[model samples]
Target chain A: MTYCVGLLLNEGMVFLSDTRTNAGIDNISTYRKLFVFEEPGERIIVIQTAGSLSVTQTVIAKLREADEDPDASPYPSIMQAPTMLRMVEIVGQVLSDVTADISAKVDRMSQSATASMIIGGQRKGGSPRLFLVYPEGNFIEATEDTPYLQIGEHKYGKPILDRVVTPETSLEDARKAVLLSMDSTLRSNLSVGMPLDLLTVLTDTCQVQHQTRIEANDAAFQEMSHAWSKALRESFTSVR
Target chain B: MTYCVGLLLNEGMVFLSDTRTNAGIDNISTYRKLFVFEEPGERIIVIQTAGSLSVTQTVIAKLREADEDPDASPYPSIMQAPTMLRMVEIVGQVLSDVTADISAKVDRMSQSATASMIIGGQRKGGSPRLFLVYPEGNFIEATEDTPYLQIGEHKYGKPILDRVVTPETSLEDARKAVLLSMDSTLRSNLSVGMPLDLLTVLTDTCQVQHQTRIEANDAAFQEMSHAWSKALRESFTSVR
Candidate 1:
C-alpha cells in the first residue's frame, strides 16, 4: 500500500509520494517512489508511483534507458517528448509493458505485478498537465473541475483534496493540501509510512523549483501533522 | 454498498447508517439499515447493517419471527437473550444461518449473499457493549482501546474516528464524531448516501434515548454538513 498525490494548479504542479514499500508486514523497506526527468530548461517531468515496487522500478529503469539511448528517437522518451501528454504516453507505455512482463513471470504464484502512477510537469511551450496513468497504459488528465489526482491508499486522504484543490489554487496552498492529505493517509493507514518525497514544478519554468524529502522525524512535518490534528479536533468541537 | 458505524462510549452507544443501496450505479434505491429492538427498561439493542440486503433483511426477519413465536424458546432469540454477549451470539448465528441459506439458493449466479452487522446496546444487569458480527457465526467486541466498529465503505470515514473516538468520549461528541465520519464517507463515496438513520442508547437505562431519521432535506443535518466543510477549510487554511 502507498499514497501519492499530484496537483495541477495555476502556479504550477505538486507531487508527493511515500517511501514505504512492503511485500508483507515483516518485509517492509524504504524505496523512493518519486522520479524526476529533466533536461534543465527544456522539459521537466515528475513521476510518482504506487503499487508493486518491482514494476514501478522497472518502468523507471526502462524510461531512463530510453532517455539515454541514441537510437530511442523512434520510441518516445520522457526527456525528448514534445509535450506533457507525449511524456505521459511514453511513461504509461513503459509502465504497462513492465507490468505485463513481470506479471506473466509471477502468474504461477497468483501474485499481481500491477502498478499505477501520477505523472505531471511542463515543457517549454506546453501548458502544465497532470495525469493518472493506470496499469493498462491508459490515462486521464486532471482538468479545472478536478485538478488533482491520487493513487494508492487514496480514500483516506481524498476528502481534503476534494474540498480544497482547484486549477486556480496557488502552488503553496497546493503543497499544503497534498501534505495534509498525506498526513491524513499516514495516520489512518500503517502501510503508508514516512520519509516522503515532495516536489514542486513552477509553471513554464521547466525546472524543479523545490524538491525535499520529509523524514518521519522532520520537525516541520511533525509540526504540520500535530497542528492539523489539533485544528481538526478544535474545529470538530466548535462545530454547532 | 453501505456505510454504518457504531461506537460504544462510557455514557452510552451511538450508531449511524446511510440508507442508499445499490446493485449497480443505475440500480440504486433507499433502504434503512438501522434496526432497534427493545423491551424498554429491560433490553435495548441496535443493529446497523451493511452488505447484501437480502442477507440482512432475511436475518432481521428471522429474528422478528422468533421474537414473536411462543415456541421459539428452543432457539435463542434476541428478545430472550440472557446477556449482551448472548444477544450478539444470537444475532450472529441468525445472520450466519440466513447468509448460508440464501447463498446456497444463489450459488449458481456466482454472486455473494453475505452481510455483516454492528450490534450494540445494553440489557438489564449487563454493561453497554458493541460487537461486529461477521458473515460467519462469530463476532468481536469493541474494547476500550478501540471503541468503534464500522462496516462497508469504512475506510473513508475511519480517520476521524481513529483520531477522536474513545470509551471516555462524551455521548454528544460521539454522535458528532459518527455523523462527521458518515459525512466524510458520503462526500467521498457515491455508493453511500442519505438519508441517514441515527440512534443512541443511554447507559443503564436499557432504552433508546434518541432516534432520528435525517432526511436529505433535514435542516440540522444540512447545517452540520455545511459547517463541517467550512470548518475543515478554515482549519486547512490556518494550518502552517
Candidate 2:
C-alpha cells in the first residue's frame, strides 16, 4: 500500500509520496516513488506513482528511454511534451502498456500487477494542472471545486483535504496540510511507512522550487507527531 | 454505506453509528443501525450493523422474534443470553442465517447485498468486551493492543484513532474521539451522513450509562462540527 497526494493551487502544485513498497508483510522495502522530468526553465513535470512497483518503475524507465532515443519523433517524450495535458497522456500510455504486458503472464496466478499515477506540473506559458492517471490509460483533471488528487491509502487522509484545501490556497499552506494528512495516515496504517519524497513547484517558473526527503527519524516530523498526539488528548479532555 | 465504531475502555464501552443509507443517490433514507438488548442490571448487548440494509434489518428482526418466542431453546436469544460471548454467538448465527438466505435471492439479481456488525458490552460480573462480527458469522475480539472495532467507511476516520485512542482511555474521552472521527468521515465521503446513534456502557455496570441520538439540527453537534472546522484551519496555519 502507498499514499500520494498532489494539490493544484493558485501559487503552484505540491506533490508528496511515501517510500514504502511491499509484496507482503515480510517483503516490505523502501523505494522512492517521485520521478521528476525537467529541462529546467523549459518544462518541469513531477510524477508520483503508487501500486505495483514493477509496473510504475518500468513505465518511468520507458519514458526516460524515449527521451534519450536519438531518432524520436514529433511526439518525443514527457520532457519535450508541449503542455501538461500532453505530458499526462504520454505517462498514461506508458503505464497502461506496461501493466497490460505484466498482467498477461500473472493472470493465472491470482496476482494483480497494475499501477496508477498522479501527474502534475507546468510548461512555459501554460497554466498548472493536476491529473489522476488510471491503469487503463485514461485520466481526469482537478477542477476548482476539487483541487487535489490522492491515490493509494487515500481514505485515511481524505477528510483533511475535503475540509481545508482549495484552488486558491497558497503553496506553503497546501504543503503543510498534505504533510499532516500523510502524518495521520502513517500513524494509523503500518502498510504506509516513511522516508517520504516531497516536491513543491511554483507556477510559470517551470522549475522545481523545493524538494526534501524525510526519513523516519527526522526531527521536524517527530515534533509534529508529538504535538498532534498532545493536541488530540487535550481536545478530547476539553470536549464534554 | 455506513460508519460504526466500538471502543472498550477501562471505564466502559462506547459505540457510535451513523444513520444514512443510500441505494442510489436518488434513493437515500435514514434508518437506525444500532440495536440494544438489555435486561437492566443483568446484561446489555449493543449491535451496530453496516452494509446491505436488507440483510441487517432481517437479521435484527429474527433476533427480536426469537426473544419474543416463549419456547426458544437452551441457546436463548440475545435478550436472554447469560454471557456477553453467548450473546455475540447468537447474534452472529442469526446474521449468518439471514445473510445466506438473502444472498441466494440477491445474487441472482447482480449480487450486491451483504452485511457485517460490531457487538460489544458487558454481562453481570464479566469484563467489558468488544467483537467485530463478519458476514459469515466468524468474529474477532478487540485486544489490548488494537482496542477498538469499526465496520464500513472505516479508513477515512482511522488516522485519528491510530494517533490518539488507547485501552486506558476514559469512556468520556473515547466518546469524543469517535464523534470527531465520524465527523471527519462525514466530511469526506458522500456514502456516510448524519443523525448518529451513540451509546456508552460502563464496566461491571452491565447496562447503558449514556445514549444519544444526534440529529443534523441538534445544537450541540452543530456547535462541535463548527468548532472542529475552525480548529483544523487554525491548526494548519499554526503548524510549520
Scored by lDDT, the top model is: 1
Alpha-carbon runs more than 4 Å astray in model 2: A70-75, B70-75
lDDT of 2: 0.86
Q: Which lDDT tens digits does candidate 1 get at residues A52-71?
A: 98999888888888888947
What TM-score would each prediction reach against the true structure? Answer: 0.96, 0.95
Which candidate number maximizes DockQ? 1
Per-residue alpha-carbon lDDT of model 2 for A1-240, expressed as tens digits? Answer: 999999998888999999999989999999999989887887888889999998999898888888887266323588877778888988888888889999997888989899899998888888888999999989999989999999999988888888779988888778778988898888778889999999999888889999999999999988876776666555555555
Against the true structure, candidate 2 reaches a TM-score of 0.95
TM-score of chain B in each prediction:
0.97, 0.95
Question: Best by TM-score, which number?
Answer: 1
C-alpha DockQ for predicted model 1: 0.85
DockQ of candidate 2 against the true complex: 0.59
Q: Write the per-residue lDDT of candidate 2 for residues B1-240, one digit (tens) a residue.
A: 999999988778999999999998889999999999887798888999999999999888788878887466323678767777887898888888888989899889887577999999777787878999999998999989999999999998887787668999877678878999999998888888889999998888878898989988988887877877777666666666
Instruction: Indicate the TM-score of model 1.
Output: 0.96
